[model samples]
Target: MAGNRAWILKSRPEGLPDMSNFELRDIGAEPLEDGWIRVENKWLSVDPYMRGRMNDVKSYVPPFALGEPMQGGAVGKVVESRSPHFEVGETVFHMLGWRESAAGPASAFNKLPQMPVEDHQWLGNLGLTGATAYFGLLRVAEAKEGDIVFVSAAAGAVGSAVVQIAKAKGMTVIGSAGGADKCAWVRELGADAAIDYKDGPVVKSLLAAAPKGIDVYFDNVGGDHLDAAFAAARQNARFAICGMIENYNAGPPPAFRYIMRVIAARIMMKGFIYTDYMAEMGDFYRDMGGWVASGAVTGRETIHEGIETAPDAFLGLFKGENMGKMLVRL
Candidate 1:
């Protein structure tokens, strides 16, 4: 039986994900079956990694099956349970498919501790994206006090969090965003300055903003933007290769001449994935959650209403349409 709403990947894209790549199916309820709980979806996260998942090649993760429900991070309330561990009316987050409803084993979901939806989304912030920033900046970039740090995608989910976290650690933060408004948003997040990447030649602007060569580069947008960061980095600078949002929607692999700058300038460049550091999360959650509660660290999110619009919301990340974390309200 088809329900009223589910976003299915009608086809994978050769480049950007447009509305035509997805099909909204009106799937009604399916039987709970044994040992399964049926959850009414409430919120879903739209992230950059979803772009890579659309490809047919093997990667660190599996490709999303074509013509099936595409899945990402989601939260929902259990309306019915056939398992012993969960009861009705409990909320949880899981790798559930995109829809108005989902069914899975109790073990398939993690029970959300009592907290605001924002806090429950710690699974999102302090979860994958947070860990990405944490390990990337601290361990890979080797962030130090008084370092001049530049982060691309500075107003999106991970970038917003990176600005505050670096600020808290006593670094001078400069951010790069797609527009003037997002530039202002990043400055409000405590970055010392924010450059608009859209304003022609990010390299020239970044060089002008930092004046002194950049000590750390947290690259969320690669390609030309990364090329710019390289031009501005100081000797022995640290580069944390996080995501390449700029080129994710299209393009050939970026040129590597700039990477030679890393060796010539003695810059340290490293790439990291969050799943590699799940073991250190207990400590990060305690430290970072405290910073958030104390107002020392803050996060922002752009919420799009309705599961039907989730694809549009996700596609928005490529355009810098979101200010902070992007979520879809169900």
Candidate 2:
């Protein structure tokens, strides 16, 4: 029997994770079992949410067990199948990531739909990241035509999608990113204004960009970004709180000096996870899929080659190393 290589959690990270927290080892593959399929992972997604799962605390998703392979999103090809639902050579998307291969029940994998986009995109655009942007902006934030929408981390996967979608919907878009290049990319994505947050205070930059105030905020990076959103929100504005990458690593929460603006402005702020709108995924695919095909929405990826570099890819998320989705190709 051949061996499989997998990354196992060596220890729980205290603050920022390091290579020391992970261990890669070779283990023998189990014999094929009935009602199961074995898949060779081709691409794995490394996202900000995975940082929360690293903690040894209870949350929406269970924590990764010590000395075990951590789970994530992966796109793979089935090599062996004992289940009628899947066949050899078929491509599938599953949650058993961070390893070279996975063998599990057919129900654990979703057959990928044939699309013009690349297969790895199933882990990003047209997948979780895209869905998060669609639901957060259109549904949760209740963004509408002529609304001025501000998105933090505007060069990231979810935030980039939000900017493009808002533009397509006849909304005025204001985006904030860390560097001049990222800000330019935001503008190229159809943002009415792009603020380089590295220049100065985010609140000042946002206020300057949208002097009339903003009607919607798609928050991907919290901290000063959240405080800036509150300060820039117009009366009766809507805020869709998505991932808070700013505070993902263990640190003291940002002191929000503008929180009182939420009350005074009567802003409606709500936090959401994409799974909460799974019932509406079909709608998202129908809309976002068309936009992507028509070039109205652009999807980008930063791929880290080889499974051995997965730890660096995941760590890169905190360093603003990726402009879009961060992925590891096995």
Candidate 3:
């Protein structure tokens, strides 16, 4: 009588998504096909990028179909395997999420290697969020030691990782968060200063935090934060355009007032996806793994229990409800 519990896209959200847009359904067991495996997801990722997939629009990834189970990032166990590539009890990271269980071709999953970290850590510091921070700061932004780096959403998942990694690499980091507590946490992550964006205008606070101007900017919240970065950028500053959580639910707003500064400051801003570095996975694992083991970096998480709570966790990303990576423990 056991069935897989899943959250389906009942309808496309108009402005801000609500519970009405999601429906919990039961996916009954199905016969396994050759070269396929059945996985029971343990940890599900709730990210800002998933918001774009809710709308029926052209993007880096396809939109979630109506009345179908949604997908994001998930790490699970192989409960049943009909493929040589995967074995029963093996841990795997896959794209099939927003559900308790899924049966798919073995090629759809990556068999996780034996690691000293927790199983969920593969979904956090060693996962997409961590990789995003790593590539964005080091590769995209070309951040180096002695650089003054500014990161928005510094207490959130990717931003927090950028703060820690930048500090560990000997760069002076300034982080901005929405609240006093979140700002304090950013400071604890080794940022030279933490700007509380809610306290006043981000530009004013950022200018005060780094009077000399920042050599690099890692952006998460785009609207005012991007404006602040442009105003506070040093000559030839580099920017890694990460997520724009502000405009995710809201339609694209007008360009930043300081948009013209890109030419004035000779800034180089680039947007990138983590998958673009698939060839460097080994390099990422080695460096990030050592940093994690040496305590030079840490992964923080805010978890919601059960598959039914997944929608709420996803919804919480825009509301600033999570300190680090928001995850659902199924």
Candidate 4:
């Protein structure tokens, strides 16, 4: 039997997530139980949404339990299998915990087709992050041709996707990132303009970038970003309220003042979770997969080379240290 390491959540975090909240342990492999398989983890995602999971309060996704293995999206290769649906040598994606290995029923994981060694991995641009951008922008924001699309956190995983998708739809895109490097990267992703939110007044900058006024705002970072989006919206503009990475660290949820703009601009603001539209997965895949294959759209990954460094990679998202999808390679 082999022993594998796992990182578990020991306590709920206060403000920013610290290394003290996690503890490492070793689990020895045992005989497979019925309907279950053992997987060797290959890649794991470190996303901003994971911050919300540490709290005890209920959210769109359930909170992580103390003393339990901290769970998130992971891709792994099956080393052993007892389930008929999976077999040895197959790779799968699941809500497996942060671990070198996992054993779970076939129903717990979605099997992925094996790809060439150089092919795009399923953890980033080709996976959920891409799907979130495709549906959240096209479906929720209802982007139209010639629309001025503004996206916050434009250098991050989902934000990057929003920029490319908007450009492909024949809409002018403007993005906001934390620093100059990210601003340049957002422009490389096809945004007509990129604003450094850290430079000055965010709303004022966005307004200047899109003097015609923004028709669609695909918001990933909330708080001040949302307020700014509201202020820059055109009459009858649509705002898609996605993840709020900005306030994820704060102890209490942040408040925003936007009633006046909501009424005056007649802005349509709506929040969406990916699961709510699982029925649309087929459409999303058809469009995104084609775009990815043809090089019409692309994704970038900021990979942390090993499992031990996963915590730092996860913490970096809050600090804007990553320029694309953050992944930990095992």
TM-score of each: 0.92, 0.97, 0.98, 0.95
Model 3 Cα RMSD, 1 decimal: 0.9
Candidate 4 local distance difference test against the native: 0.84
- Candidate 2: give the clashing pairs: none
Every candidate's lDDT: 0.82, 0.91, 0.92, 0.84
- The runs of at least 3 residues in candidate 2 whose Cα sits more than 4 Å from the true structure, single-residue gaps closed, are none
What is the alpha-carbon lDDT of model 3 when measured against the actual structure?
0.92
lDDT of 1 by residue, 1-330 (tens): 246488888888978878889999876787787888988888888788889999898888798988888888788888899998899998887887578888877788878656443633654565567767777787778897899999999888888888988998899999998888999989998999999878888888988998998999999988877888888889899889888877787777668546668777898888888777778877677767777668877767788888778988988888778888888888
Over the stretch 119-140, how does candidate 2's per-residue lDDT look in tens digits? 8888877888999999999999
| lDDT tens readout by residue for model 4, 170-278 | 9999999998999999999899999999999888898899888899999898878888888888899999888888778874455666557888999998898776788
Using lDDT, give the best candidate's number.
Answer: 3
What ranking emerges by TM-score with the best candidate at the front?
3, 2, 4, 1
Q: What is the alpha-carbon lDDT of model 1 when measured against the actual structure?
A: 0.82
For 1-330, candidate 3 gives per-residue lDDT tens digits of: 299888999999988899999999997776899999999899999999999999999999999999999998999999999999888899999999999998998899999878888888888889999999999999899999999999999999999999999998999999999899999999998999999989999999999999999999998989999999999999999999988999998878657888899999999999998988888888889889989999999978999999989989999999999999999998
- Candidate 2 or 4, higher lDDT? 2
Candidate 1 residue pairs in backbone clash: 2-27, 2-28, 3-26, 3-27, 3-28
